[model samples]
Target: MATTPVTQGSTDRRRFRVTGGRQTSPQQPALSRWELQALLLILALAAVLYAWGIGHAGVHPYYGAVVRSMAANWHAFFFGGLDPSGWITLDKIPGALWPQALSVKLFGPYDWAAALPQALEGILAVWLLHRIVRAWAGPLAGLLAALVLTLTPITVALNRHTIPDTLLVLLLVLAAGSLQKAVGSGKLLPLLACGAWVGLAFQAKMLQAWLVLPVFAAVYQLAAPGSRLDRAWRLLAAGATALLVSCSWLLVVWATPPESRPYIDGTTNNNPFTLAFGYNGLSRFGDDPHALGAVAGTTASRTSGNTGWTMLVNDIVGPQISWLLPLTVLALVLGLLWRAGQPRTDGRRAGFLLWGGWLAVHVVVFSTSNGNHGYYTAVLAPALAALTGGGAALFWAEYRAGGKRRRALPAAIGLTALWAVVIDGPHGRFAPWLLPVVLMLGLCGTAGLWSSGPRTTPRALHSALAAGMASVLLAPAVWAASCLDSRYAGSPMSPLAGPVGPGYREMRHHGTKPRPHALNTPSVRDAALLNYLTAHRSGEKYLLATQAAYGAEPLLRATSQPVLVMGGFTGLTPYPAAHHLNTLVSAHELRYVLLTTRRPSTSAVFWVKQNCTRVPPRAYGRIADGSFTLYDCAPGV
Candidate 1:
């Protein structure tokens, strides 16, 4: 038959023509013109939310101080020391602090300079989630998943700060994406890269990176085009690769001489091994299930009843996150129900399994840990978003095929919509009018889905789907918007997001407020103490000795001078023994010893109290806690 030629890139046009042949319809592009515009809009929104008012002095002055110190010298930067003195290391890994250090080094040390890298990393995370979900589920799922991630308030709050969790989350997302790419290509190199990504994530947050390895390995083994034994071998090699990457810095720290390197701060012994495997790792889960301050958020006064599973429900996570949490759980259930007993090599099933594994592992681990923070739960946001997008897309595609599943789609849509609003709506802080509008639109969307017949057009179907998703998203979107302006100075641990009125002010680092121990900036009282130390320095390395890092932080930040903290975060851990303190004083490395009232008992404190003279209160300005004693630790005083 004589036929008309088809246009290039048009498969359907080639298949059918009006030359004694039938015609074919045009198929849509992977990302349609409007969808592409929508994607850009979503990314723009994320950028504004993450970057807005990000320049305030950081929430955790401790890490900000570390970043400033790391930017000053090579030793402090490499070892992640608590200050420029390089006398002691910070209580965490070096890698997590590196990006912020670099940011400060390049842009000059400011809170915004330290936080800029994390904000950028957060933006990239949104884009990466979209790319990964789109690969497994399709473009619509990818776009929807990205939208969900950007709207998560906890994600926005944590990302806007200088916390290392932002980097950890980004690296883990990269690892997830790498494995998805490997499954698609059936390539060994991409699989290898996935392990490397996980290893890098470990550098960001030690043991937390390995949580997803089981899911990645299982997916790769089943989906990769290779023999089972060979795949297992490769997986082991990948694990080895991850181990090596994570342990490289540890090896360097271990290899260094004790005298030349800063002492590891967190552990009982000043060593990297104990710091990694003990303090920051196993000790996080208290053996005694009900240890005090074991689980975070609940121990705080406002979150009084937030314990166990409810930790992620109301006070801690419910209002901050959990807007789409019920739907995420529903997505997991539906994913399992939809793809029961599929092939081991099923890609969609693998995607669902991966996301489910993330949520399951984190929830169980965090729920059990007394050391868990509300901010720690922020890492779960992307996984929840990915599952929602992929699961919803899978269900929609299946329903469109006119079967038993199709009849249930409308019901699922309606139920999920109602559950999303009802779950956190009452506890949520949103505009008075916003809640009613969300409910009305959600009801209309549910009705549209139920009333939709086979004759319903594609545009109408899409509109209904958009409405349903938006209903799940509205509260979080409002919260995330508020996340942009929230100023949680000193410690930005709160996950509560809301609008900041003119009365809302950033918490400044001054002694006016009842501070833990000297704010980063000096008040009149602190300045008087600083003047005394500066005046009394008799050729000493440390200007003064304090009970913990809290006491020394203000001095170090204000004067760029060396001040020694005997213990670390808790102030109880033994570090410098009496002999070490005597040696420092004898060697003229330390002079004045300032002890906080109700401080942890140490032989060094007793040594200073017995051997040195206490300064009179009249010599220093008015002190908040007069129980804090200043001892003259000068040699032969």
Candidate 2:
């Protein structure tokens, strides 16, 4: 039997003809007028959503400071230093920050410069998704998927900031596309390329990128043209490739001598594996004594709501990424059932399984895991978009065939509308009119589909189908547009979309407050403190010592000078023990210290308060708010 071969040219060239009992490829043809138009429109939409007003989008200062440091010095750049002087490395891997650091170097460390990479990656991700979906299903399906991903509120929000998730999503999408190609062509190269992509994605997100491994192997095993044993061995090869690529940079860091490089933050022994697996990995789910917040005795849950099966549908996350989830689920089930009789290499069924499995694994992991931020849902956008678009195409093809499948489109539309209303909740505070409009469009489409009999024209059917999809998409699009508003632009650390949740409320309130050390400038109070420290400076190696990155970040951002963070990000990680700090002070290598006034101070903080002279608030132009105390460790004092 002649099969359709995946091709880079027009859809016309994808068909193969059997001539003289042999398969022959068709001549390459140009894209149809509609395909070109849709492709351009999708690209345009992505550009606008990700690039418009990106200059003003806020950045994560902690990362921003690190980017600046990396740009200023190659040593810091290689190690992901937290300050220009390379006193300590960032808590997380610096793979995602390399592009931003290079951008800052080229463009002079502007906020937009750091953000440009994410925006470009986001737009590229959109285009890549379109190409992948178009190759598997059709141009229409691919265009729909691209549109859905572009309008995903969380996707839009994260792309506007300098977050790692942007790169992670792009690489994962690349992996999925490569996996599809490997399945279509039955080649080892594309399979290995899939693993390579996942490995690179792992650099952006440590263990989270590995979540799709099972899905990839399962899809390829079921759909790729190979014996089960051969496929299993091929999968092992790919996994090895992934592990090697993931550890490429890690090995470099580990091999560097301790004295030659900055100490790895978030680890007691300065080990990268401990930081990656213990601090960033398993510690996220279970309790850890060393976690900064946990050690500080804070009771806050890291997630937006309580962890459970219903976590995704809760008010906080539902508005961000769950708008079309129900429709996607329905489409997946119906599509799988519709294609049940197809051969094992069936592209449509393979697509449903691949994307559906991606969604399932993430849902399970996030539902049960702790320390999950809502924006972490950004990774799910591509899978959801692909499934929704592919499902739409599946149902529409069946509907056009004039059979029981005709009910699938109308049912999906109605169910999506109801789900949208539920996600909007009782108040519908963010966009009250959206739910009603969705219902109205859904009703119109369902009524038209239900009433149109065999007499219905192709044009009429197309219009009804368009209305049905528009109903399901309306809520997410509007919610995504909310991020365009300055009030809803999101915070640097935690990006959220829509105005319906506690996270949004908190972010909105905090988004407007000025950072003490924004960009290269410091606030007036901090400027005064910096002047006092600089004026009283001896030949100390560091300007002063502070509790953690919180105090060090602003000082480093304001001036590219070295500021010692006694502890790491949370002031709980054991770095620079009390004795070491005392030695520094006694040796006059550090003359001043700034400790938080919060109770239960770390041993280092307690030591500073006991051994160093308490600088008068008036001396540093501070009002003694009891929040922070500046200590002077002058040698003769």
Candidate 3:
């Protein structure tokens, strides 16, 4: 086959042949033996990173409760309800948890079962990223991307938990792959499929998934084999399909009468659109006063610190996701600059822009958002991995040609190592020897790359390249491994990895496990309360009522019996109004209410205190510090 050379080096010349507008690399064999081995090795690493010791992993109690409920009750499953009785919906959409719920149904709701889907999704994401990068660059680049993604600290941490973001990342990566296919084939079907994938991702995460729409549109419009007008119209059609798919569940809930379905959390009017666009979407950027205020006042939000350009590299987020930011940014800039003279539809440039845009959009959004958790940055892993792998491949090929870009490879290695050491500085007490090893590898690799040329032995060149890659990746690998430590077990909600605080260090020093988060591991007092309520229950529709999901989550996880969350996640959702509570009490459908002792009570608490008798802590086999008041709401109590 007559081929067009894509790379300049005669020693390792790679050629691309375009046929029927699809770009195919003639030099790279399909699934060569070495490639297959590397692929399998990377997958094995991902499996170990995401699935090891998951049986003992802690579950996020809020989502865990929903998964158990959804597994048992189709009503709760369809609505993504927080309780078995489907009384109230969770704050976020339910699609991401669907896989975990199904896993629970098949495997009996064990922690491993709930966590199994994300681990598998994470592995699939790695494989998909490899395929896409390999198609654009070569097998070596693909394998490196897969390996980088596999070892991303936040990706490892998120996949080990039952959280929405894991599924979101998987779906978004799938969407990227589909968009790549569309770019290659210039077909309507692939574009539509890409839209459908993003729409499905929207279900996993409301508006966050749509962040890549601009990237997808730009890449396809700039790279696809069609007139600009044709591509523009096709994109419109795809956008319509995405909107329809994204609104699929919302329409169902809207059609269901208020009395027939659970109350939608995080919205005043119970409208699904309001919840999606207002509470989960615009509020993330501080557009809605109430939602933003509630989010800002949260304990997790308070811990996230202020938002700014430096947030991603700050103490809270750097170790989890920023380990590769320097390398990734340099790769994007240099790769695009080198490819500037290529045609608009150049596949290599398209790959750089696609992944680079993905990383850039997320950086701006996450860095400037009102509040976000460390695990939220897991979405950036695939992009960073792609840029690193593809850029390294481009830089190596250029370096071998004795060109001006030869310094790019060594500079990337040096910068990556320097950033790794800087990030590792604060955590030096935890891994003192790590920085020295990383520095040595980086220095040696940079020197080797700087000196070697076409005259260098193949073995020496490969060794130098391997050392450089290792220097860039070692710290992230270590940080990712820290997720499996017992001292980090309590953070399923946040899903943070590494030495989070002095508490983690203290636990590590003592060789002890930290206490479980309050929302997951119920206290002995909670056990006593559960026992007391169960003993006195009399055909009540609800076992008891509590102020918010936090108070009710552990109970829901412990049993299938329904517990009403009076105010949703925060004690301010105004769900179960006092009149509703009075109605339930008068009808003998709710006989108990649990209220915290904090002053300035909500209306539900006020009603319970006025009409219901307070049960002494002595009745439940404990002395009270006035932290909580359990009320007997039975009629005429």
Best by lDDT: 3
Query: Candidate 1, after superposition: displacement of residue 422 in Å?
Result: 4.7
Best by TM-score: 3
Which tens-of-lDDT digit does each residue in 1-637 have in candidate 2?
1134233223422333333322333332355898788878877887887778877766787888788888888999999988776878888889999999899889885778888999999999999998787776665677889999999988998998888999999999999999988877677899999999999998898889999999999998897776788788988999999998988878889999989988888787788777667677766666774543222212221343535798778877787898888779998898788667766776667888999999999999988886477788999999999988777776666666666766887888888888987788754766778888999999988788777887889799778877888898888888788877755656677677767544456645775432322566677888899999999896888899888776777677667677787777767667778998989887878998888744346788878878889889989888874678888887668
lDDT per residue (tens digit) for residues 40-158 in model 1: 99899888888877776244556766777778888889998777778788777879889988888888766677778888898999999987887666676788899989988878878
User: TM-scores across all candidates?
Assistant: 0.86, 0.91, 0.94
Kindly report which residue stretches of model 3 are placed more than 4 angstroms away from their true locations once superposed: 1-8, 11-29, 291-306, 488-490, 501-514, 517-523, 598-600
- Clashes (backbone N, CA, C under 3 Å), per candidate, total 3, 0, 0
Any runs in candidate 2 off by more than 4 Å, and if so which? 1-30, 287-306, 501-503, 506-517, 586-588, 598-600
**Better lDDT candidate (1, 2):** 2
Clashes of 1: 3
TM-score of 1: 0.86
